[model samples]
Structures are given as C-alpha cells and as structure tokens.
Target: MLTVMGATGNTGKKVVELLLAAGQQVRALGRSEPRLGALAAQGAEVLAGDPGDAAFLTRAFRGASAVYVMLPADRESPDYHEAQRAKGEAIIQALRESGVRHVVALSSLGADQPEGTGLLVTLHAQEERLKALENTNILLLRPASFFENFLDALPIIQHQGINADAVEPDHAIPMIASRDIAEVAARALVQRDWSGIVVRELLGQRDLSYREATRIFGARLGRPELDYVQLPPEEMRQAMVQAGMSETFAGLYVQMTQAFNEDRVQPRAGRTADNTTPTRFEDFVAGLALDSANP
Candidate 1:
C-alpha cells in the first residue's frame, strides 16, 4: 500500500490517480473530507486530517509499503518556518515508528542550500531530518520552479495584459510541470528495488526566461506582444498582500524572487536515469489556458 500526503493538491492528486489506475492500493490523506471524496470514489482509502498531526499520520501511514510526503506552506501561520519544521519533525518521527520502507519527498531545486532560498529552507531541513533515518529508502524529488505557479498570475495577466514578478524578464530559469513531478514520484514509489537516500532533479524540457515564456503564452492566447514586468520589492510585497498573503509570507516570496533574479539559484545539469520527465512549456501553457477558460 502507498500512502500519499497532501492528496488533494496538484501533484499528490496526480500521484493518487496514477497509483489507483495501476491497481495499487492507495491511502490519500488531506485536511478536507469533501475534497478527498472524489479520490475515495476512485478507489483510494481517503483519510481526512492534517498531515502534521502525528496521530493522523500514524493511522494513515500504518501498513503502507511506501509514502509520498510534502510539507505544504501555510501562509496564515505566524511562524511559517517553525510550522514547517514541526510538521517535518512529525513526519520523520511517524515514518521511523511505522517501519515504512521508502519515502518520496517533494522538495525544490534550491533545498540543498542552507540559506537564501527562503521558503525552501524548510525543505532543506526536512532532507536533513530524513537523512538520519537508518534503513529507510528516501527519494528526494527536487523539482525546479513549477509551471503551475504561473497559473497564479493568470488573473493579473488577463486583467492587466502583463505578467509581473521581482525577477528580471530576461533571467532564464528551469520550470517543470507538476505532472512531471507526480510522474517521477509515482515511478519512484513503485520501484522497491532502490534503497538509500536518492536526490533527483526534474527539469521540464528547457530553461526559458520570463520574457520568452511571456512570448509563448502570448502566442497561445492570440496576443502577440504580451510582456513580463519586474516589480519593485515593495510592489511585489503589496501585490502578494492584496492576493491575501500575510506580510511575512509576502516578504519571503519577494526574497525568493530576489534570489532568482540575482542568479543565486541556478539549475543543476546532472542527469539521472530517473529524471526523464518530458512535458514542455507550450504543452503546460495550453492546458492552463484551457483550465482557465473552463473555470
């Protein structure tokens, strides 16, 4: 049996669906019952509770052969980093007690760095905590910036005719579709032959600058000259706050963009046999456009 945390989320939902389609037993855990009902209907054992709850995690993870884990950020938390650390500690403790043989952790590209990655520092701490577990196979799927993240910009783009970020328009960065991350996670979970802590980086097809990405998006939307603009840090913070993020969370987001713009987070070039995900930016954009039009 495979237990998936954050099962209602984008990547976790895909992982649950893929596992179910393959006739594998899946326990899907999330904080909401209504959201998990669809997955339950599709042959998943739905567990409704917070993954950070140790009792809930123990119940959800018991008897599972492998597990997929991720510590999702809570924008409303007064101390986001502490919340993440507490949650990560809980998962590690639960995993150690449950005797689960393997874990596929959803981390980011810059999680290896101890500083400067802001929110990703939590994932770095998670990796360190998980590394101390003996006789457990841990797979760290470190994906670059998600193409799905751009979906959050759709409202501004549609209304203002521009995409905004703190990063420069000309700065190229690797972006992967969430589906690719899910695919890699599912593949890793099923392969019980592999053991030890393995780190894999998922880069979609190529790295493209925000300017280039805007051009592609414009072409697909039938707008030829849609562009990306770099907002000042304060402007970025205000925008995030207006979007309902807390001031602290907004500041951290701005810090992340600063790191990206300054090229502090560069894409790693190592190729692993397990890192062969092939979703292109054009394909991802087309799907997002369709989802937006329908929604």
Candidate 2:
C-alpha cells in the first residue's frame, strides 16, 4: 500500500487521483475529515489527523510499503520553522517505527543549502534528517517555485493594479505546476524507480520572471499594460503578514526572495527531460483567469 500525507493539498490530491487511476491501494491522509471523506468515497483508505503526531502518523504509515511525505506549507503557524521541524522529525520517527521502506519527499529547489535560503532552511534541515535514515530508500523531489504561487498575487493585482513581490522583476526562476510535482511523486511511489538516495529536479517549461509573468497575466486578463514592481524587503514582509503569513515566516520568505534576487538559490542539476515539466506559465495563467471569471 502507498500512503500520502497532505492528501487535501494540490499535489497530494493529484497524486492520490493518479494512483487511484492506476489501480493502486492508497491511504490518503490529511487534517480535514470532509476532504478525506471525498477520497474515501473514491475508494481510498482515508485518514484525518495531525501528521505532526508521531503516534498517529506511525499508525497511518503502518502496513504501507511506501509513503509520500511532505511538510505542508502552513502560513498561519505562530512559529513556522519550529512547526516544520517538528513535523519533519515526526515523519522520520514514524517511518522508523512503521518500517515503510520507500519514501518520496516533496522538497524545494533551494533545499540543498544548509542555511541562508530563508523559508527553504526548514526543508534543508528535514532533507538532512531524511537522508540519515539507513533502512529507508528515499527519493527527494526538489521542485522549483510552483507556478501556482502566482495565484496569491491575484488580489494584489486586482486591488493595487500592479504585479509585485520582493524578488526583482528581472530575476528569472524555475517554476513548476503542482500537477507536475504530483506526477513525479505518484510515479516514484508506484515505480520505486530508484534505490538509496535520489534527487530529481522538476523544473517547469521555462525560466520565468515576474516581469514576464506580469505580461502573461495582463494578456490573459485583458489588462494590456500591467506593470511589475519589486517591493522592498520590509514592505514585502508586511504585505505577506497582512495576507495571513506569520511575521517570522513572512520575514523568512522575504529573505528567500532576496536569495533569488542575488542568485544564491538555483537548481543544483542540469536540465534534462527527466527534470523538466510540461506546463507553461501561459497555460497556468489562462486557467487562473478562467477560475477568476467563474468564481
């Protein structure tokens, strides 16, 4: 059996869907009972609980041969880094107890760094912990900044009439669709394709900038002349805080953007068909525009 954490999230749901379609036995888990019920009705063994609880997760991991692991992004956490570390530690402990021998970890692009990657430092720390597990075979999927992150800018654009972030407009970064990440996760779980420790970089169709993204969003929304602006670090942190991120997480996120602006964070491996994903920024923005119109 294959178990998936964050089963209600974008990547988790897609992974579950793909696995179910492949006629695999899946245990879908998340904190939301209502969401888990939907997966249960679709023929998955659904569990709803806090994954940070080692005992609970141990039970969830029990009887599964492989598991998809992630520390879901939680902006509301009062202490984001501490919370993520706790969750990661719990996952490690649970895996050790349950004897699930294969794992597909959802990690970020800059997670290779031991420090100075801001929001990614939590992931970096967790990756190290996962790497130390002797018995478990681990595959870490280090994906680029998700294109869906652009959705967060919709309100800012609609209200303020500009595209903005702490990262400079000219800085191009690798971006991927969550669906692509899910595809890799589902395949890794079902195939058990690699032994020992493996890292796969899932870069999107192209390197894109907020400036170029602004043009796409404008074109998709019929705005024609929208502009992209780089906000100061403090200003960006305040904006994210007001938008519901904790002050600490917001500050860390700003630092991550700074790392991007200064070219500190980048893909560790060269591009290949194995690492590239198909979805384009245009396709994502088009879908986003449709959702906005329908909503």
- Give per-candidate clash totals: 0, 0
* lDDT of candidate 1 over 125-150, digit per residue (tens): 99999889999999988888888777
**Which residue ranges in model 1 land beyond 4 Å of their true spot?**
270-276, 289-295
Q: What is the lDDT of residue 74 in candidate 2?
A: 79
C-alpha RMSD for every candidate: 1.9, 1.6
TM-score of each: 0.94, 0.95
Candidate 1 residue pairs that clash: none
Candidate that scores best on TM-score: 2
Residue lDDT tens for model 2, 1-295? 9999999887999899999999999999999889788889889999889989999999999999799999987788889999999999999999999999999999988899988989999999999999999888999989988887776777888888888998898788888899989988998899997899988888998898989988887787778688999999999999989898899889889999988988888887767777889999888877764554421
State the C-alpha lDDT per candidate: 0.85, 0.89
